[model samples]
Target: MRLSIISTHKRIQKGDIGEFEKLFRNLYSPLCHYAFRFIKDMDSAEDIVQDLFYNYWKNREKLEITTSLKSYLYQAVRNKCIKTINHQQVKEKYNNVLRLQGQDYDDYSSSNIETEELNQIIESTIDELPDRCKEIFVLSRYEGMKYHEIAQRLSISVKTVEANMGKALKMFRLNLKGYYQISANQ
Candidate 1:
């Protein structure tokens, strides 16, 4: 089966799909388990693994294998899981802030409006950040990358990554001060 997979990988590189199903079947469950450790949800883990495989097949020609195929798949799943977890953390943090302040959850319309406004403000602040600052911030916060990893990916020093992240947080805090005040008042 491993030889067959190597052969299929070769054919896949040539834009063929003869052994695609066999390959998918072989990798799917293990990759899902790998993702579930990071994501902590069965469905999301499956989705992450499926997307990883889909992307692998889609970009098969450009795919380089310094490591084994299993390693590459696991890395992709890990990255996706980190992204999912970060997004969920942001959402949960926002919700908890509202709930803790004893906001009027009975007023569904108002609650939705406040949530939308907060999200909009966050989006706008992120958009207004300087180009490199925004990129570093997204990689670190949204993608859950370490400062070292972000520095390596951007080919900059870790100190630069830390400085940029500090700037991003400062900008966000300044920009959202009014919203924070409003939330506090509520």
Candidate 2:
């Protein structure tokens, strides 16, 4: 039986198209069913089995089948199924990684927009402050000046400087929360 199988394989290798067709007719359905057991999809199983036969025929000159033809065909079908499953897994992983990267890009873009909008709101709010309050706020924040230094420089009471700083702080707090709502809603 083994010798007959090998001889048949050799005949197919020697460009025997009729012999190859007979072998394919005998094995194709069984091979597809065998592949479906592993892959769980009839269409994919049929394709895999068909591809296996096509590749075997195309590369017959380079291939050697040491076992019985039945064993060789079964083993080849199993290997093709495993390869298909592995390829599908790789494609799924690649797609998942792309999705995560897309989300990261979106977050980075929104963060930049939020920062720019907050800066504009802050600048406009600062401009609206009472002139003395804005000056006090800028000096305390931008120039890193202490309250007493600002009061002496402006020839104002320390209490007056403190009042102006409090009003500026309150305005900023309200704007900060308002900006948070605007960004969150969008």
* Top candidate when judged by TM-score against the true structure: 2
The lDDT leader among the candidates is 2
Task: Write model 2 residue lDDT over 62-176, tens digit each, in one string.
Answer: 8888888789889989988999899989877766776777744456657778889888989998999999999999999999999999999999999999999999999999888
Model 1, residue 181: distance off in Å is 32
Q: Against the true structure, candidate 1 has what lDDT?
A: 0.84
Clashing residue pairs, candidate 1? Answer: none
RMSD of each: 18.6, 13.8
Candidate models: Cα lDDT each: 0.84, 0.87
TM-score of each: 0.50, 0.51
Model 1 TM-score? 0.50
lDDT of 1 by residue, 1-186 (tens): 353336666777787776667678888898888888897889999988888878888989987766666666677888889999999898777767768886534565587888899999989999999999999999988999999999999999999999999999999999899998998998
What is the lDDT, from 0 to 100, of the residue 111 in candidate 2? 78
